[model samples]
Target: MISAAGLLVQQRALAGRDYRLIGHSGARAAFSLGRWRIALEVLLWAVLALVLAAPLLALVASSLVPAYGVPLNFNTISLSAYAEILFRQSITLTALKNSLILASAAALGLLTVTVPAAYLLTRRKGALANLIAILIEIPYALPGIVLAVAFILTFAAPLPVVGLSLYGTIWIILAAYFSSFLAVSLKPVLSAFLQMDPALEEAARLAGAGFFRRMRDVLLPLVAPAAGASVILVFLIAANELTVSALLWSAGTQTLGVAIFNLDDSGSSDLASALSVLVVILVIALMAALEYLAKHLPEGVLPWRN
Candidate 1:
């Protein structure tokens, strides 16, 4: 129907137009895809936060519901359950104190050990340093229950000592708490340090600052926010820790977490729920404090921001 030369030229022109249309379509699709990806990422984070928060909010609301005959219908609500748990109990009060003391103490102990060690570990990378790093890893690599059992084996018995034992003591709690979370407390700050410029520290040291003075005035203040966040995380883990507490707790030294479990075993969800809600509140308060501290912290110190 057409000459070969004419058909070839016509076909090339048609092909050119088709390619241009395809290219434009692809460009438009890419723009749409980029926008969708960003929206999806934002949506995912928002949904995750909401999902994580929903159960806690529900527990708090349910705990505040009345336990007795004034059944709530469509919109009826009351605080009888909260009042009953909060005011009408005494163990919870003890639990409150016990949890606070144990958690805060454990956090303090972790920082005491971890901060210096973390700094030291990052400052040098040699044989002894590697050994220390590996040793810290030993606790984290094994299951927590295994470590709990190991502690009980070592400290609960007097194989090496004729009369010394730390069984069922606060020290045991602190030891487990320290061992369990030391790595987490160290890792973030260590990574931050590795990425951070060391010249700042060197300059300060050269300007006649002693080692302890430099740590106190320079590095500590600089990394304090990460340290604060680590403190809160370790404290929360310590406060809510049950495995070691259950295995190693003395009657006189039972933490609130274990105590709550004990109470609930006697079939008191109301009390357990109250404790759960309180723990949530305690963690929230700790997070709020960490956030407040972060707000005041200088940019170079907690550069990660979260």
Candidate 2:
């Protein structure tokens, strides 16, 4: 009954209507998806605030209070606890010093061992290298408590030649640290080496560059960022180490972690909390510094970075 012209007009009208419906449906879907995304983001932040931020705030509040049972308020807040731990307490100062030394030494010591070892393992890739890599990782894979026990058994006896005992000394703790965190330090350096192009080293070698010169000039520069990252990571972990030191510490060898435990055990929770707050501050500062350096470093050098 319709003319051709009329049929075209009807078809165009229906097509326009369908286009409008499709657009409306698409808009609705987009809006729904955006709302869900926003909701999920909010939920994630809420969970982080509840789980992480709340506890940290509570810890800060606890550290500010003058006494353990006292409520934290403008009037009740005091820095006396911090002063007591920082100045009045010899034990705390000693622990802090010991922790700093141990952290620095462990970081530097591990770097010396891991850099060459990583290079060799990555370059050679033989059965011996594989076995050695496994050995390096074994101590780290073991639980801290188990590692501590093993170290105690191994070092309980005095040295054969020198007859020196390392059972209850800072040296033993350092040794344990070396054993446990070797893998931590090795991983980043090894990753760096693996990602490196061997041709650069070979080119230098062809140009009459000796081993030391090649490492100093070419390899070290390339892997320095990773090495630095390894140092920072190891230092952070070693500074707050607990398990190994708990078993191996002696009178003068108490570390920051042990000191905190001791303070709490002695009913000095305020002091303990104050010390913990300082440690938290230190850790945050270090993390922020590391994050800042992330841009300069290689892609996977820092673990927390992408």
Candidate 3:
């Protein structure tokens, strides 16, 4: 039989007390959250260090050791393995040269085709463009083994007109690299094209600038960073690529991937490890160079930067 007004007042008092209590505890809650965030960041960094640095350290250590089953330490380390790979191994040098050539060629080829193709795709919107995009993505989406099989089957026989066979040749490997990496090379350029304003081109057109002129003056400058990114990405992938190269390489055309596999397969694990260390060093150098170059690039050009 309490009065309604009294009940209302009591509820209000309870609410006010609850609000004051929350206000008092808010700082503690914030402090707890901050500690948790710091802890999480530290944990994440630790995991990354383990995942990335541990293997690299182990590789370097192994490469320095004289033989397999030998414990690696500063005192046990020697430069003999390095000297052997660099000076003595002819096939290693060949593999390195081939990898460099293939990677460089692939990067340039990818950029040449993808820049115009991406621009065309971005400019033209239709079912055809969509269909073509899907087609381009298919090879990249499929496993490397599948693509290798397809290439082998298609090129196993001599061409109908030229009577030329590309199977088990460097050309076949290059073709596979193109097919597998085309989509990757196109994505950044396409993204850049999509993000660009049409008004720039229209203004150039108003100035009587032709297609090539407009592309040179406006579009190329705008998308140069993306193009650079594409080149770097495609180069890295093609250089380090294994599965396709392993399947397609001939005796004289053996790439670094094939060389590495062959060395390990032949039970030259020490030599393989040594070669692998060099490859890792090369990869790290490239990535570091890219990172340094990114400062001069357009804001969104390097995907890993942001």
Candidate 4:
């Protein structure tokens, strides 16, 4: 307590000294510090973005070159490398189909499960809501590999419970994604729900609308931003899903990512690089779209709702 009092006294003395000595000059110094901080922040962001993007740029340049070397120019760029994989075979097509299918399914599944889950969760309060929130966030704690192993073990049961065997199928992949992404998807949605007024929902119910009708009309329009954000997040995760899909994929169920790994394993550098570029381009497109959507989206009630 004495130390605290002494610190307080020191702060007051320093403030008094500054005010008496510098007078109005302190305001200029404070503004200078703020500008310095802003400049530093902008510079830091530029450096970080460059650091992350440098390797991807190198990959693109390398993939476009007919011969792989340490040249820092695009003079040797050729479309043949791109053409070789995209036009050369059917497996890339198959992989593309699989990736689209998997990502779409994962996004839809996340929407199906998390929307209702987030809405209903708003009904609870205090400890129950906190517990559910924690539970929803548990997936972020588990590594992808751990989740994959757990999923395989849990669903690999061969006892034929009611004629369902989830041991070896694409459904396992879908389930793994649903388990992993539901938490991230729910956070945005739940935040939206918390900001939304309960009266809108109550009005729907009072007007003789069923639960589905209310969700379809009232809640969904408000939560559309969150839903779109969740879909994009889930799709990106599903498209690049490597660890679980790699472990779980069998002979006939190889995703595009798994197929790329297979090409790398088989020393098919050309094909791997080609697919890598393709995947990168596709990701870029998706991210661009998401960014555009996020910017133009009608601000949802959640952010500044009363």
Sequence-dependent TM-score of model 4? 0.75
Among all windows of 10 consecutive residues in model 2, the one with the lowest summed lDDT is 16-25
Candidate 3 per-residue C-alpha lDDT over 7-68 given as tens digits, one digit per residue, 9 for 90 to 100: 44544464323221112223333345666888898999999989988887877777788877
Better of 2 and 4 by lDDT: 2
All models: lDDT? 0.69, 0.85, 0.81, 0.73
Q: Which has the greatest TM-score?
A: 2
Q: 1-306, model 1: which lDDT tens digit per residue?
A: 123344345444644231211122232233456668888988998897798777776666556554423344546565555576678767777666777788888777777787788788778766687667666766765566887898888788754756767887777767787787777666656654554468878988999999998898888887777677667767777788888778777766778778789877876655676678878787778767766876644333333353
Candidate 1 vs candidate 3, TM-score winner: 3
lDDT of 2 by residue, 44-122 (tens): 9999999999988888888899778799888998999899999999999999999999999999999999999999987
Task: Give the top-scoring candidate (lDDT).
Answer: 2
Considering TM-score, which of the candidate structures 3 and 4 is the better prediction for this target? 3
**Sort by lDDT, top down from the best:** 2, 3, 4, 1
TM-score of each: 0.73, 0.87, 0.85, 0.75
Q: For candidate 4, lDDT tens digit of each residue in 33-86?
A: 666898898998889779977777776777776655636356666767678788
Q: Model 4: residues >4 Å from true position, as ranges?
A: 1-46, 67-76, 126-129, 162-165, 205-210, 295-306
Which should have the higher TM-score, number 1 or number 2? Answer: 2
Candidate 3: 10-residue stretch with minimal lDDT = 16-25
